[model samples]
Target: MVSVLSPAEVKLPDGSSTDFANLDVAATAPCLDVVAEAVADLLPWYGSVHRGAGALAQRSTREYEQARETLYEHLGCGPGDAVVFTRNTTDALNLLAHVLPPGTTVVTFDVEHHANLLPWRTPVRIGTPRSPGEAVATLDEALRQVSGPVLVAVTAASNVTGELWPVRELAEVAHRHGARIAVDAAQLAPHAPVDMAALGADYVALSGHKVYAPFGAGVLAGRADWLDAAPPYLAGGGATAGVSADFAVRWHDGPARHEAGTPNLIGAVALATACRVLAGADLSAEAHLVARLRAGIARLPHVEELRLFDAAAPRVGIVSFAVLGRDPDELSTELGRDHAIGVRTGLFCAHPLTRRLLREAAGRLDPSAEPPGAAIRASLGIGTSEEHVDRLLAVLSAPLFGE
Candidate 1:
């Protein structure tokens, strides 16, 4: 006779029990022991930060603040700028969108994450560009046409194609037309050092999890004035104090305004740790690995399509390629289920870029024709081993495309 069991009693791959149905990054990426140690550092404090005098509270406050400082230095944010802790890249972009003054026109490319695409209420979407110069020209043209206060929002790299956008040149073009720019560095920050000054973007947003932090924390680093003037992103006890019976209240300052409620001290610290770890790794070497992988994948049969946005543009450790006679979902699923290989598939929340790449490869627009089912994106960080690359290539090259 079979015995019924509670959901919590269900065993996992190695015979461990958990309460919830687990899948996705939240479940898979945090199983390592390193993550547990990183999380332990921030759990001892319960008292409110700045709202209490308790030792644990103060320590927690310090930990949170130090994480902010570490992130600031890591991203090259200067004294005149500030770092606002966000839930993720989408939250960061929303904060900026909410703070943008009315009549502020936005210039952005068609090839951006929905987080960047949906925020600007009225955006002048620059169509897909085949080269860095073309990308810059698209931004310049958009900025030239808009007649009000403007912000140019851009992705440093495309999430769908893993193609690097001309962010530096785009920033220059925006400034030349009297507009400031903000970069969606979610894809680039993890792969390289995001130098805001060097890139000349007015603001930059990134995710810790994507950078190997795998925590629920993120950051928005940029100019101080707009953030200081804008209202808080989240409203709660820690965001403001001195609420009156008459209903008036005074809000907190700097990062505190945006970060309400209890801060994730441990998550912040772990993110900081992850950033430091990645910082010391050989970036050039990782880049070389990415190039090698791209080159190798391009050589495979049934790879019917290959497109790298710009030959000369510097990129990070990411490759997105499609195979002929194979569905991306089937490929990604087989890779993971049969071979323990992991990669992301589908539009990657960037429909425009996916369509552009497919159209370019197809040589004609056929909305009805099943364009290659998104892309198979293989991304690497400091911890990525050569074995991962070899495994991915082997899976792709196996005689399974028609199966």
Candidate 2:
């Protein structure tokens, strides 16, 4: 397991301190010790990349460029792929949205997080599917109607439900219909190893924060042809090749074209280090924890596990559920206040899916009550211990939670 800052002590609402069981790893993961060490070592030698003539600048340029290579190898990007650094996943997807050729259609499902759903210029949305085959068929049918260059945008996993999507199958479907695919891997990359070529995805976006390297860094890795043909995402010194006094600027091609301003040197290094480390990481233990958590949820009759497909669908270390007649926010608060357990409560930023799942759960659990607006999510990560999982299960299994 990755060495992350863990079991952090936090003061309870009642003024007592306890080791916090951070079950909200899906939101923002705790920083890895290796990433912190790497950043600390770079602070003294940090300098502007691609501009200064000093030794530090030269070293900084090498380090920054090497970081890009790390990410390239991490994702198994194609020979001509451009690994452009951005603020985070949102910024990366927005960059892709901007660089897409004019009149290109963006086809995506409605169950996507806001980051993937909103960046497109009037996207053609497909309805949510009950199964992976249905999802692939829906995209194929949708693409058959749209005439032009199309980009199929989809998430590798559902943030709200933690169910893994069939990205490879979706990519094949997109290609069969003369369209390319871009994956929003913000949630998937941290939990599983991602390969661009294997998935047949043209573009992949992910954030550092979710990958245990949180310092405001992300990457948009994909084919360079569209990026080179399109205008720069941002205009500044690094992006331009030559600018005359008359302001006739010739822009550079590739990653530098989009990464215009002074880049986040530290953040990039941290992000790259995380990707490199996670490439060979052993997460079977965390998988066990996920199995245990889901099994525990199964024992509680009042708990309705949120999922897009059936329980057999592959997922990460995230388990979201709504309890019968319980307020999700209040449940999260009680866990935090009394048991030092931290869980997330809300729509999980994928509103359409959450609402649909909640409504479906409402019908099955109790038709008399209204649908829940939110759910309680307990996600595991590198630092999550068996004790954390057991404690959370114990709290939810208490007498107050019984039917």
Candidate 3:
């Protein structure tokens, strides 16, 4: 297993310390040992890239550019693709939105994280699907209604339910309708292999923090045509070849057109190193943990594990659930405050999907019961252990947790 930084122990409200079991890898994974080392190794020679004549600057430029190549290959970018680094998935998607053609219509699902949903200019939102097949069919139907230039943005895996989407099918549907597809892979890339060619994706965006390289770097990798033709994302020295006092500027094509000013050298290297480490590593261990966790949750009659598709569908080591008549905020707080465990609670940035699932689950359980506004999400990573899963299950077994 890849070595991750130790999350260490947490202190209880009574000032007692205990081992902290982190089950929130879906929110932000603990840093990898190799990612931290890469950052440390690059820090000593840190220098601004692009124009400096010093050896450090030249070396920095090489490292920064190499990071781009590493991400491009890791993401399965096409030969004509351009890899542009940004702050995170949100920034990356926003850059794409900025560069899109004037009359281009954007299509996305209501299930997206705010990162994917908010950046587009009046995106045509598709309704949530009951199954993977329904997703593709629904998207196809939605696309058929719209005309002109269209870009279909979809999530590779859902952040709320950990359910994997039908990216390849969606890609085929988009192409059949004369549209392009972009993948919001912020959640999927960390848990599974994302091959752009295999998925037939034209663009992909992902964040470093969620991939065990939390130094504030992200990637937007895809076709170069639109990006190359757009104006510079940021009008600054490195992005422009020539500038005049009257505000006229000549912008460089490719990645540099979007990545203006100074780049995050250490962050980029760390992200690239993490991408290399996690690329095709053993995922069965995480799957085993998921199986154990879900099975344990099933034993708790009051607990209802949230899912978007069939009960037997495969997930990426994440389990979101609701306990009868319990507020998720209070449950998550008590878990951390008293039991020294870490998990995420609330809508999880996928507001529409989360709320809809909660409502649907509520209606199934009892028509009189109100839908929960939030849910508890326990996500696993390479660093998560079987003991941690068992520990969480044990804690939840206590009948009067609120009392």
Candidate 4:
């Protein structure tokens, strides 16, 4: 079983205690028990990595390097690939953007999270497709149009709608056009297996916080040539091999070239431990739990579930919805204050996609005035339980807040 942190009991507005139903796992999953234990085990021997000659430093350095290898294996990266640790998914994608060769054109969809949407030099934004096949065709056409050093950036899963993209097919299209593809797997990695080599992706970025390791660590695993050739992400003592009195310095190659300064040793270990745990996890069980939650939500009246593709499209353990005649922000607050059910609200960092969905929902409602600006997202994962889903559905069905 996947042992996660015990849910905390929160006191409701009416002075009743209830276990916090954390349905916001897509934003930042709570730490796992094993990850906390790993941090405890490493704290005693903590030391500056790759610096001191003492036993503590040596042990810490070894563990840090081992964590890198663990992540590489978990992601199923190629032999020549390198894993560079960063603060989170945003940091990783920005690092890639900074290192891209000059005059590179990035082909991406406007529906991506801001982290993936931004940071590119010249982004050719693709229109939102109604289906997976349309998405693939749109990307193929866009890639064919762009010439010279093109990179295709895509999200493995929609953080807003939880729809999974056809990453392997997209990668094939990008390769056929002589371009490389980078996948933002922040939402996908937590609930599904992400094999970089199998997906034929040149790069993959994910966040630790979204995968039961909320210790401010993330990874960018892929080809090493561009990373090695680019300037160090941070210019510091650890990144330089030798420095002259006049300030001339030679930088180290490989992952160290991009990873400068003091590394997050504990965060890296926690992330690696989470990855190892997830590698052996039962994803199908989690999928079934998500399906149950979706079914419960479907039974609720006046609730419209948002989707980028068909209703039967395969998605991760996330569902976004808008309750008619109710403001999403107000409803989310009520869910937390009255029902002790935690969920996310608003555009969820995917403004374009959420806005489009809101417009569609409004058109279905009246085909007239402006669309609603926000929605609610209830995402599930290993930490979620059937009781939690039941509680949410029951609360939604009740007339507590006049819903």
Candidate 5:
């Protein structure tokens, strides 16, 4: 029996309703259904794929391969393109970093996650773009400085502030300079629609765990040549067609070249299933959730203090802020334990990005240090409800700021 209240009022575990300001869509139920459907095939050991001939194995293989095709179609990729499965976004970026021709310069911003920044092999530097306009100029200057085979790696949106980057503009800049762009769509893909070909990026990488499919599978989809020319990310039986007595070998083509071994058959299938489920959700409704969260946050007197990073930047579903006299860890733990609110805290793996935001606010990373510190990050997912938002803000209002 479905509840009478609108979908937003739907109740979830821990006694919270489904109207969380940050969640774009209610994904828990759908996610549960997806998991249930794939449960029979979920195995502890990696199953044989592509080479499996038995009925169950064949069915699983078909599902896994089909998942890749579905992802390509979902992202609107064209012919001659390919999608190689990886363990997660980290694996995907590492694969690209290694495959990039030697001495290839990579251009990106300082605000990007480590997954985007740490992978580049050549001239690893951060762009200082105080504002959006300055960001473009900064890239323009960097492009001018480098005249070689280049790769522009950037995040579609920031994980900390939920700030969306001008990926299209970045892609245009890269293309104008004869450089290719690869997007780290880990955070953005789960929240918004991401089309690699449409976004003008040479490649896009994302993880299934963040996308409601936490089965340890991810994808690197786009340009076929660079991946084809580069050696496989891993070497095993599946990647090679033949191994001779003299230790000679022949490799497989397309995704098989990079896949290398038995794939996460169930994980791939579930990610595709999750994507399909998300595609069917009302984006307009999701947009409503974002607006609601922003408005609610505005009601708090201290909320304005959190926007110090890029006040005018378009954000997705995250809000990071520093409390006057409270530790971010203490706040996050209390929210989870006392209020049952699940929010991420700390530097969020983008130390430089977090530092940039904190430095401007006169805050310290560790409050007990010589100087008191960093900020608290509240990230929302589709499973988050409105009550979770209200409760969090209410808890924040209870003298935690220490008047």
Candidate 6:
């Protein structure tokens, strides 16, 4: 089991303290105690990476590079692959977008998070499929029509619905039609194991904050050919190998090319530590907790669970829902103010999918004058327990603020 920090106490509106029940792990997870300890241990020796000659500098550089290798192996990447660190998953995907060869057509789904959806310049947007099989078939047909060097961008798991996507099958379909696939694994990596090479993915992006690291770091690991051929993602001192007096410069290849400025040594180390800890975690226990939470939610009458796929479909530790007569925003505020529960209530950065679910629930799309429809999401993680789930359900079932 992964050890996390103790439950934090929050001051309620009545000026009383209560143990905070965090249910917003989908946005950003709490840091692991092991990760925090790892970062604390390295602070004294933290110094310039790959530059200074001091003892601290040498140690820090070695630690930084070792973090890179640790993450590479954790993700099951091949020796030929290159892992480039970025600020977060958004930055990693944006870096990939900037490096695609000219005339390369990109294909993506409308149901994807905005981080994956908005990066490509002109992608052929596929509509949300009713089922995972339909998603694969749709992509197969789309890939057959594209001629040139094609790239397919997909999410390993739905950020809004928590439904798992058929990443391996999607990668196979993309490869059969001479296309490369990139996976946005920010939501998937925290709950389940993600292996880019094993999934046959050409590229994979994930965020550190979502995986119990809580550090501003992410990774884009994939084939080195396209990344090496493309210009440096950022041009600066570290990225360049030699600069001529005549205003000419030669850039370095591998991860350093994209990581131009001073890298986040601490963030990288924390993320790597998190990967190591989670790799050995018994995920079956986490799955059981998620099942218990889902079953409890299903027993509520007025609450309707939001899902693009069937309930039996494999999902991560997330469950989004809407009450029959209450605005999700108001309900979210009450949950935090009256009770000490923290949950996310919004489009969850997947506006297209959220709006579709809202329409399905209300039978009519909100007009332009009305506020945007939203849902309350209770996302679980390693830190979640049975008590947390029970408290949330109890509060939702009872009258809120004496309503």
> For model 1, how does the per-residue alpha-carbon lDDT over 1-403 read when each residue is reduced to its tens digit?
1111123334345555433211122111332234456566456664456656889778777777888888888888887899988878888899999878778888887778899999898798887677888877777776767888899998887666556777788888888888989999887866677889889989999877776666687788998878877788787877785688997979877877878888776667777776766676556666776776777776675553335465445666656666656777887777766556567777667776776676555443233455685766776654455766776777677656532
The lDDT of each candidate is 0.71, 0.90, 0.88, 0.89, 0.71, 0.88
Clash pairs, model 2 backbone: none
For residues 190-287, could you state the per-residue lDDT of candidate 5 as single tens digits?
A: 67788876789889998877777767788898888888888878999778978899998787778888888778887788778767766665444445
Runs with alpha carbons beyond 4 Å of true place in candidate 4: 366-370, 398-403
Clash tally for model 1: 1
TM-score of 4: 0.97
lDDT tens digits by residue: candidate 3, 1-403: 6888975677789988877888999999889998898888888889978878898998999999999999888888878999999999999999999999888999998888999899899699998788999999999999989999999999998888888988999999999999999999999988888789999999999999999999999989999999998987887877987888997888898898988888888889988999999995776688889999999988775677888899887778789987767787888888888887899999898888888888877776677788787889999997788998998998888654543
Backbone clashes, each candidate: 1, 0, 0, 0, 9, 0
Please name the candidate that would achieve the greatest lDDT relative to the true structure.
Answer: 2
| Poorest stretch of ten by lDDT in candidate 2 | 394-403
- What does candidate 6's lDDT look like per residue over 255-279, in tens digits? 9999999999999999999999998
Comparing 4 with 6 on lDDT, the higher-scoring candidate is 4
Off by over 4 Å in 3: 13-16, 401-403
lDDT of 4: 0.89
Which lDDT value does model 4 have at 59? Answer: 96
Candidate 2 lDDT, tens digit per residue, 112-147? 999999999969999989998899889989998998
In candidate 3, the residue pairs with backbone N, CA or C atoms under 3 Å apart (3 or more residues apart, or in different chains) clash, namely none
After superposition, the stretches of candidate 2 with alpha carbons farther than 4 Å from their true spots are 13-17
Q: How many residue pairs of model 6 clash at the backbone? A: 0
Model 5 alpha-carbon miss at residue 49, Å: 0.9
Clashing pairs in 6: none
Checking candidate 1 for backbone clashes, the offending pairs are: 209-214
